[model samples]
Target: GRPYRSHLRPACDACRRRKSRCTTTESSDACLMCQVHGSQCVFVDSDQSRRRKVPTPHGRASSYTESGGSNVDHDDTSISMAYSGETHTHNALSDGQSHHHGPAVLVDPGRPHASAITGSTEEASMSAMLAESGDSNTHIISPAIVDDNEELDSYLSSNPAVGIRRITRTSSTSTNIGPSSRRVLFNTVLKKPLGIHARQSLAASKLEVIEKLLEPHGTVLIDLHTSFRRTYSEHKDRLSPALLSNLYANAMTYWNNSPQLRSCHPPDHRFIWVQANEALHSELFLSPGISTVISIILNVHGRPSTSMFGNGGMVGTAVALSNSLGLNRDCSAWDISPGEKALRSRIWSIVVLMDRWTSLAYGTPLLIHRAQYDVPVPSKEQLAQPNASIAQYAGLSIFLAMLTLTDVLSHYLENVYCISRTSPIDRPPTSSFHLETLLTDWEDSLEDDIRRLVIRGNDLDRAGSGNLRLSYLAVKLLLRRILCDTTNATTENEGAVQARLQTQRVAEEIVLLVQELSHSHLRGFWMPSNGFTLTSATLFLLRDALKTTNRTRNTSLKLAKDMMSSLQTHRVNDSWDLADDCLSNCTDMTDRIEAGRTFESPGMIESQYFIDNNSLMFNDPVLGFASAFDFDLENFQWNETT
Candidate 1:
């Protein structure tokens, strides 16, 4: 008789176990119940051999094939043959035979748990179990183990039941150093952020670690800045894009954020925690806290909010704040709230420096007004008025201030690299590539810093001194210095001389004010981290010597050049050779450079070399006028006829 047919059918695994029809589609690989539960699919065959029929011990069981072998075996006989064990289990269940392995349904109880299985077969088992679990089970199974080859393996142990399931789950959605050697190294010592305190502690620890990492780089940055400034001053066009970019990037980071200018961090012993969104903590693992903090400053200071404030006008707030604090009136630094006062002040100083940098770089009225010198334009009174929102603009203003920091840094490198050949303290020569290099690099850095400020204004206005802006500005300040011309303009006309002197005086005033601001507010002392003050002081001294009336413009210029040349040409083994050149060159070149001149004495170079390498050119014209005079030519010709 024909059996009653129901509209619904059993699940794939159940059908495979029962050796009956499974209505599930191939794509789903499971019946409706299994599909609802994310299960595996299986089909069955009618053939007696595919049914896992127990054979009669004495002979072939003829009745098992009573349905007819050729007619019962469906085209998909392979599928049923694959699940023959399930068929056997189903047969036993239908026969009411109790099985021992575990809770027995239609599927085989002896089959290993899906969790205990592995490979593709395990996947299949898991799918089958999922199917059998019915439609109600919706818990996402977290694979509790990770791949042995992955970095997570060091921290996450292997799981027998879950195999690498845990690892698979974790790897699905994660943003950090990859699960490789770096991850392993990180996991060895660090723990994941579990709560607020734990995360903050981790963040603080990472910051400290980053600070240490950046210490040596800070020194390198100082040296590079000095070298770049000197080189750029003399050889502006000779600079390379890559080198410029590298120097600029580094300088921008320092100018905007230094340890002295950044936020105060709690000690490692104190409880700490970081929010998950702040994934940047891991980046500090490699960079160090100081570097990271500086990076944040550069980012902030390099881009100020253009919405609330006009272009570089953001610096007005910093100046106002500095003035209010009764610090250096030049807006070198400012103190705000207790927690972030130091960092805020540092950022303000950077902003001021950046404003100058932009003036030099873009050469725009917003920054640079006239061809000869930049006009010190103050902002409108309304903008200087402080409010909570204004504080945010303070952050934005810092970013806008150093947009060209990178370029300035490059210029600084150019100068440093060129003058580095001379004694450290020697006055830089006009034709020695130092002047052009400094101008070009500083100009380029200022341009870029300003552009970034314009673009990042919104971000700065919202988050005062966010990592992005802070990093940008810090790099700029890390690479700043003043370049003074040793050749002062000399004029016999009283009006002309007074005019020149007045201009020089103004320039000197500006320079001195800058220095004073640097020393008092920015703490530009000769510490290992702040050794750039030496270079600044040397330039100021040169400016003073140039302003003197005892020497002609050309004579003092020649002296300055001779001093630098002697320092480079002679071998001096003194710690202060560079400083010595700055002093002796002023005296020697002013007195003598021509043969038979009163300042000349036999072997003057050798005599000075004995005193110090920088003083080797004490009275030698050849030191400064190598190109001016030609001893080899029988008929020497001066291009600029005297």
Candidate 2:
């Protein structure tokens, strides 16, 4: 049994974690301790993986290898996470294939590693953050992991060989914070975003010499902020990883910027984008600031060509950050400078845009609802102002147009799309005429830049214009669909008939718009977010096409199929498989000509973003344990399914 001395081979990660003796000889693959416990046999250089010295292929010092072999482990945190199935570990020296040891790291054996970050399933190698910290605030993870903070600390301290103790700190003066802020370790944020994972990876990649790569694409991403020079001048004080990583991710995705950036998405550039996200992931919790919120806004504003519909959590985080920073609240009356106030409004405007887009697409509730925020809309004078940030984000006209259109979308979602209502929803109101009036007025007010038709090459403003139009069309489409879905055939009126015909017409416009504006550039924008409505539109069209055998309705059905074909590009380009399901449903429904056609919900993607569908109608005993309340289900008629 080992005491405090460092072993030649060192202990495997799990064994070292518990400070147990590794009873394996030189010939055994796994030690007796690991084999008996049914754990993997892995080796790692110590000093918190960051300073672990690994020899190069030719037995030379790798440039990345830190000199210190006895540095203190600074990875201590109170919030420890526990994983399921098996103990998972990650190491920084992932690519170093060093079976042979170089410098020996002294083992304190009194403190256990608790900074568990990314856990992987690989048994042969390790990466960053393996062992879980035992922080009480760590919440229960779904399916597998949970934060068993106290239990883990007790287990580590219980070992006779490993006398692990919680690390703590104290301030010399009573100026900084109360006793509560000081812990085993505290985060001291620097002027610049220091110790960023992306910055480290970027340095490791040695991409500074690649100025050709940086200027063409990286510059374009910088311009996205309106004027990078102005943005830089304003913040010339320091750097932020959240902001930098967001730009990197934007260039790497097929969604944002110009075609030039997306087309030149080489393997190396894409790798930086991937690494950028890892950096952003670290920044997600490491710090919270304006740059972090902007990074999140950019992250959700456009997606990587290969990513889809998972930004719900990211959007929620942005909303929380926005509220915390007073982005949702009006800063106009504040004593801040005009530029700063304008910037806040712009950022808040986009946050609202992304929130509604995500909520609509995922069939979820609004994070920042209408009544929740008191921020005022911008005036014509503000829109007319020559601001770099405004221009960088498709000008103020486009923002205003989008802002108004999204207001209508939010109204629809808060009312028509809401599953729960104070009273039964009015399915077919005689009119969505007022909502239509607002939408039409917004479209009419679009300035020359966003209103201009796409004549030639990829005009960035045309994209803004096209996307704005698409948003308007989608709102109009959804409004019409409500009338169509709720109107019964037994009492079919002229308005209901017109609404049905209008549904097909809107689908045609959506498909045609996708064809015209180079849809990939828009990243499927409002079209896909209105997926449920799209499904509803397509199904109703198909029913009319077959039922009446009308050539116009048939043509509408054809357009719906063509639109699906365009969206299919997301499957190949964005790595989303959503089209296959909806497409198959359309095809299968078409094949079964004689199936009963009293249409129900779109049934495309039954997204449970935040609200539980079951909890809305029925109460569960587990959730309401010891409660006498029961839903009167005796009179509730469950729908008969085939």
Candidate 3:
């Protein structure tokens, strides 16, 4: 009545005897699952060594059988020829129907009458043991041939089973940049106990590729870092290699469109990151000098990781290290040399900036508060002015602007947001006038060159200038929302309408600021902060669109759709994902509004359309309930289940 199920590939002996499943795929052996569970894997008969059946065009199935019974890990390199007399013949026995496109299961025929081996054993990088016969003819085993020169990602996608090959650990020091070699090194360091020296050697080998990739941009990456923290420039060579790896990784974020940069940045970023993680642990357990703290900070901003080792944990680690080093105290007046005092101040300022960022990002309380530390802002003397490159002045300007902006954020989060407030947690917010005064004072403090850039929102085209302008707009936007957040009686008043208009104006400014940011260097740097900025602005626009008519429909829809596409392109962090949620809600609102539907808002018919998607504002898998406006929205008190 039904088609026959091919029994060519059988379950392994361990799986059959124990009545469990063996995790074998097209290019791998049956030992993976057993090894994971610390059990021995065995195949009972010769037929069990074959792979599972795959579909053919004629509704028939085909199975590949290896010639020999040994479960050796297959070489992931593209080996083009079979040693049989016929160049295209293979060890596989397929159905009579011709299979046009499929994996070329290259195994030795093991037939006694097969022709003798012809290839010289030529060594390849990262354990790619390729057999090259020195002949000009490249044998075509099947019509569907995977190009030998394809990139690692493409080959791995089509050859999923190749990455699944078990990493056999040996004391061998050689490694390569191929997918299989990376897997081998990953398993060796994680599964097996690799010595520090062996690990160092492996880590050192990974650097060769990085050097070649970065050769075009000499010390641009390192120089940019030195400009930001002149202290780092002073002791640049003294910094450990592990910390340097992390610095390079962060620099890659600025040029994310590059395929090479994307493959090596952070958290789950391959090769380089593994070595960085080791250094972080070693420093954490020990004193964790300034270098380690800098590494952790770079990791925090490079990209957000959801694990405990992510931004939240890294912030805490950096904070603890700062406290231990007495960074919270005013090191400026310390009896130390000018260089040493400036170094401590600069480090503390950056640390405080990140502490606030992670707090907002994770919905946690602020880790650095004024009451806890008396550290003063870094003076220009702290920034390298004497031996400074021309780029140093621009970098130093941005660095100081960031420090002052951190003060503004700290005040808002402490006074307006309440999560970071030194006083009672649920205390009523202070007057918006006080926060505005603080902003005005900070604005006055800005140098002439920066003040000019900060005022004209459209001129914020540089990465530093763009981010700086966005940070300033954030406080202005928050203030407008708070002024407009009112009870039922105030909803229809002229004041409420004016507040919404002002807020809308701020959102429009943000939209202008982000028009060039979709795929630019500025977007890649400080990405999470940029994600939150875009989300807040989008939310405001979507709210305006939902309450208004069809005139603004196209702009809202296009912006949201474009944002969703951009965020999906990188899938960088939880913030991007949350921002996507905001875009999705905007699209849905536009559709519903265009269809002549009137919806009830949570508060006086102006609140967001919190529909069936209950996880809209909060409930991200990693940054749980840490919406773009977590503290601000927590005050809104919208009922999700409703």
lDDT of 3 by residue, 1-642 (tens): 322323665566555544555667666554565655433456666553455645433221111112111111222222322111221221111001121323334333353222232212110110010111110111112212222223332333323133222222212221232232121111100111211111122223334445455665525545444333433444443344445666666554343343433444333344445555555564444223455566677666664333434667777888976765455656343222344445557667878887765554455677777877777887655565456554445656766786787787776666434543475755645665775788788888887878877767544544356666766776567656656664113566677777777877776766666554544434423435445556666656654555554443445444544544554453453233324444544555545533433444324233344442233334321112221111100011111111
TM-score of each: 0.24, 0.52, 0.54
Q: Model 1 — TM-score against the truth? A: 0.24
Better by TM-score, candidate 2 or 1: 2
RMSD for each model, in Å, please? 28.8, 17.5, 22.9
Q: Candidate 3 — which residues are off by over 4 angstroms? A: 1-238, 255-271, 303-309, 416-429, 461-463, 486-493, 516-527, 549-609, 612-615, 619-642
Q: For model 1, give the RMSD to the true fold.
A: 28.8
Best by lDDT: 3
Q: Kindly list the per-residue Cα lDDT of model 2 for residues 204-310, writing each as its tens digit.
A: 23233232456555555554343333444434324455455555555343323344544554445456555555555655554445555666665554333234444
lDDT of 1 by residue, 1-642 (tens): 322334344234344433444455567544664444322344333342246655433222233223222111111110010111122121110101111222212234466432333344422221222111110111111112223324444563322111111221122212243332211100010111211011122333343443353454433333324312334444333322222222333342233234432343322211111221122333233212212222322322321111213323433433432322222221111111121222223333443454443332222222211232221222222122223244334434443333333334433433333434457565334442554465345435443544454334233222222222323322222222222222323334564544444433432322232222211122111111111122222232343343344432433234344444443332142222223423443444333333212353435533432433344322321122100000001111111111
- Look at candidate 3 and tell me the lDDT of residue 150: 32
Q: How large an RMSD does model 3 have?
A: 22.9
Highest TM-score scorer:
3
Cα misplacement distance, residue 508 of candidate 3 (Å) = 1.6
Indicate the residue-level lDDT of 180 in model 1.
27
Higher lDDT: candidate 1 or 3? 3
